[model samples]
Target chain A: MSTLETAAQPEYLCRIAIDPLSRVEGHGKVTLFTDRDHHIRQARLHIVEFRGFEKFIQGRPYWEVPVVVQRLCGICPVSHNLAASKAVDQLVGAHEITPTAEKIRRLMHYGQTLQSHAVHFFHLASPDFLFEFDAEVARRNIGGVMADYPDVARQGVRLRKYGQEVIRVTAGKRVHGTGNVPGGVNKALTLQERNYLLADLDLMIQWGRNIVKLIKQAYALNPGYFSDFATIRSNYLSLVRADGALDLYHGGLRTKNDQGQILFDHLDYRRYAQVLREQVKPWSYMKFPFINSLGPDRGWYRVGPLARINNCDFIPTPLAEDERREFAALGEGQPVHLTLAYHWARMIELLHAAEAIHELLLDPDIFGDELVVRGEMAREGVGVIEAPRGTLFHHYRINEDGLIEKANLIVSTTNNNQAMNESIRQVAERYLDGKELTEPLLNQIEVAVRAYDPCLSCATHALGQMPLYVELVEAETGTVMDCLVRDADGTFRHSG
Target chain B: MSEEQSFTLDGRRVPFQAGQTIMAAALAAGVYIPHLCFNREFAPHGSCRVCLVGVNGRMQAACTTPAAAGQTVESETGEIREIRRGILQMLFVEGNHVCPACEKSGACQLQAVAYYVGMLAPHYTHFYPRRPVDASHPEAVIDFNRCILCELCVRASRDVDGKNVFAVQGRGIEAHLVVNTPSGKLGATDFSIHDKAAQVCPTGAILTKHRGYEIPIGQRLYDRKPISVVGDVATLSESKGGRRHD
Candidate 1:
């Protein structure tokens, strides 16, 4: 009986959860568990809500879906509009689209990425850099940046406003733009509109350069600043054009392992099951999208900033490439294994996108005519675009009557399941000493998770408005942890 | 419809769809109907009678009129045009709409449609009422003096947003948009100019608070283009500030 009793036993199950994780576009949570050796046993990331846009879009006309989907997120509405319209265009299968329309479409995509990426950094990510992560939530906003370095804040606003103007001039509205269509863009950019944008664009060019310099100066001043977050190497994925350029809208998929070896390139999307697998866990609503051949039990992969940096063959823009090379110098390796390095990588991508935009605007077709695709709506198709967070995949199957029959939205956050899980574990393993956890350190882990800007509400719950409230419960006693909250300026603010 | 319909709008016989509004059928039939508050953007609320059409009997909002498949729809007739003019006259009379001084004058949907229907003179006495202007939002303005009470903003806030940031408080003509989220300003609430509900005003009621002088009048909406210009707009993020609130 004593011999039969001998067995491998489970040890401590460390559970962690952070509701309303800071630094992300929307609300989210991260949970992880570990044994006594600090070995990660399990990790789950739950984005607990969905607005059911796909189901609601059932009977609405296809053209209206882009506009409706644009309302899904105030942060990156134009990206949704572009992806939806592109999907509708593919289904229509019109080959008659003129070059001028293509020019406008590319310009719009550039404009959307420009504004969204700008907001992602200037408005969202910079807070952690400018203010202490442990600082009071009330004072850790744009005002925080203003108080510490007003010049940076002012420059950010100038840069951000300039990028948004491109959207305003072309999309008519920035957030919920609708000027794009399946056949082509709705209108041509007038000479006058172009001139209006040119002045601000000139200002942005100066500001963008200054931003790179500031980041470089900060890095030089603190050489070891990145070592703390480095070494989170995971299999990375991104979209690159036929020439392996960093293409935002039109591109084929590129997936690579941590060794910088090209595992796959331009794989047909219809056979996506061959490359990706979703392992559903009971703890989290989000599905773990592991590299299919990587095996099921073998988990942990990263996406968004870190993944994009790892997967890319080379930086496209000249200036961005230099900065990217400098970034690689911090950790001399093929795939830098640092999660914190994601911020620097993201800034490089932003610089690249801005430079590419200026080049695209110079194309003569952008100012020409020939819009609209001639076709009847009676087909189904897919449109994949790069959201500010990651690659956003939208698949729709419409009926002959031109109504949506089914919709599958694999958003930016959904694609990076393995990566996020790995990042959480890595952070936990590194930060959580063999000691009781403090509130601020836990929140730092939360901020680290949200650097991807995962829009979980857009990921799941495709039926109605998703409302998720994460509560802290006492494990044995089943008592609620007191969460003190007060209404501050019509929004919930917490002070302990 | 099973019902045989024939209608003469501007001396043309147009078959009207059963249960379809006169404006809806006319729009489907390629007739250019002018209206300020009536946008297909939302279901017809009938707050603006700019789409006033002469039915078989009395004047009606073409957007709200039901075409019974057999009904005659007089859309472009002189009498209907004259009614539209009077509605504009009353709309202008009820508020302070100084076109020469207004920012939305050239690009304003109201002024453009009014010009299309020939509302040359107000032909009515001005109300000369003093209304509150909310300049609380650093990026948007709510000028009650320029509001036409078309309920576009109200409906946008209540119906679309599911957030009642804006409401028509008080009774009768005294009804005005009340901001219940403190300080009577949009910025005070979770509201920002980016919300669809906030920026969809038909008249000069709610105006873009910033970047007015950035783009000259010659390049603004309607003055240089049409609503169909939706496809031509480019998406540029460099110079924009994301809405103050997500």
Candidate 2:
């Protein structure tokens, strides 16, 4: 059966769509097909925006690729920055960057991960979870959280702000900082800036623990609902250290089968194209990435937080290691297929990030001055990093004249595209009925998608205003039956 | 110098010598006027129009309009700011000012000016013009795609560098920065990397070879402070060739 056909249910003849999916990064929609009998036939998540960063970077100078390609996603610029920089580092034949440069880059990566995850948890996903998913539309934003739980909201803002501050200090400015260069980074952390960030580490750690406890409590309060909602089984993929420990900044790529057995271990990222392949579907602009050996049917694997936690054997940090033990227990010797567990896993990573930052700060190398190493230039190279969302890859081929001949970027979100569709389908199958399309039903579908904290902007490389809305269209006649619109600021209204 | 008469600029007292334009007067008085294509070392060519100011409720180029005594000039007002922002947007779309990839990013007057005026989003449609990059020169490269048609290179080459190797060719929207050689290549001309034209580019149009990202990014000239306090285009245009040999 074809990929789109996998969601087939002959009984359904109508469509239920969550257009311009809200609380996500960019523009997307979830379309569910059902018959007159109210049984879901098929469901697919369609990424609406299409940006071709891969094509245009060609012909530009090789040194410019790192900077040019980072424009792919504003929210995750540091991911692109480091990925592109690492790719160029290969082109320059710099196999090992100086210690200071590596540490500084690692610091910046952690900052990006911390801030991005904080925003996803507090500003985006927490709203749904905090307000019980079916809360009034108007009181379901950051403002609403501020009014209800002012202290928790303040902690979120403060933690996210600290992450931004760390990024700003290490990268020059918070957004689109030009710190990462071809060979390595362009600057090092100053003593003053280090002290400033050092001052916040304690508070950030405390807040990270508090938030983790809150999420843990939430999971405990409704374990069954959280675990079963939109749940699906898929393979897991992430980068692991030599000992199979969680290493987001630098590590070897690893993949495990759905049963949690290692499929590939310590494989070089340059050979990623060999193990992974992209399958395009006509319905969505986003491509489906699957394991090359398994093919499309069972090759689809999960990435980001849950996958990272599942694939890694251990977390090096003390508190995160404890949380990892608990998280692992959820799977009971196998990979956790619970979709809502992604949020819990994200918090664990957040705690790990806080601990990692403290370790990096104490390292004397982070304050050193040898940031870049000049070297012989090569024709081709690839760089990969575990972004806040998932593993991001940037590969480039340059001509002898130092101009880029070809470029290909695999953003983190694209890896989860197929799995996201599968999760949406699971939600639709569970709650969606053709008898009546209700707001709560529409929101449940959204909650499933949001659990991934997918950055659609990075996934599709979108431009222009991204509006979120859901429509129920008759599959037979392609006519709209019901529609819900979500404005830019997270305000929901039933338009039709 | 006619007693160096003072004029009201953005409600601040700025004194100017005879024959100085509003931009020069503001620069000297430590006040910033957002501009491109207007340099103090050479004659002011108000071609970029990014520094258009309101004088007595009339729009005029700050680089060419002389500072008159007791004249009310508004440079930072809402209307003038909007006009400057619009002009910057037009310049952005006119050429591909890829700041992230450009060598002159942190030190580029264009980027700094854009930041100063708070031009966050490019509201207008992007032309995404397909311009060419001339890398024929061994020591210098000219990326026409980043040129804002400021003519700073043209003037610097003719006036200060005395190379006459650069010129603005064509007219109106179709105009472009061109090398004087018959082949229109920097390598075909005698323009040295040390030429003032090479140093005076407000954007990353003209860059010296092997010196790309040499100064790094954060610790670069303009990274520490705003362009207004970092000596504007005049001080930035001055050669600082003693740092490293490329």
TM-score each candidate.
Answer: 0.64, 0.86
lDDT, candidate 1, A408-471, per-residue tens = 6667787766566556655666666454545555656665675665666642211111222233
Per-residue lDDT of candidate 2, residues A1-496 (tens digit): 2233445553346766667677778777777777778777777888777788888877777777766777777777889989988888988889899999999998988888888889888887788778876787667767788899999889888888888887888877787777887788877887887888899898898898888899988988898998899898899989999998999887899999989899999999999999999998877788889999999888988899999999999999999999999889989899998999999899899889988998998898988988888788789999999998999888999875677788888888899988888887777777775447776677888889888988887644232124566676666667777777767655657786
Worst 10 residues of 2 chain B by lDDT: B237-246
Span of ten consecutive residues with least summed lDDT in model 2 chain A: A459-468
- Per candidate, the number of residue pairs that clash is 41, 9
The regions of model 1 sitting more than 4 angstroms off are: A1-17, A31-43, A95-97, A135-138, A220-225, A270-274, A296-301, A329-333, A375-378, A458-473, A480-496, B1-246
True contacts kept of 1: 0.00
Report the lDDT of model 2 for residue A31: 74
Candidate 1 positional error at A174, Å: 1.3
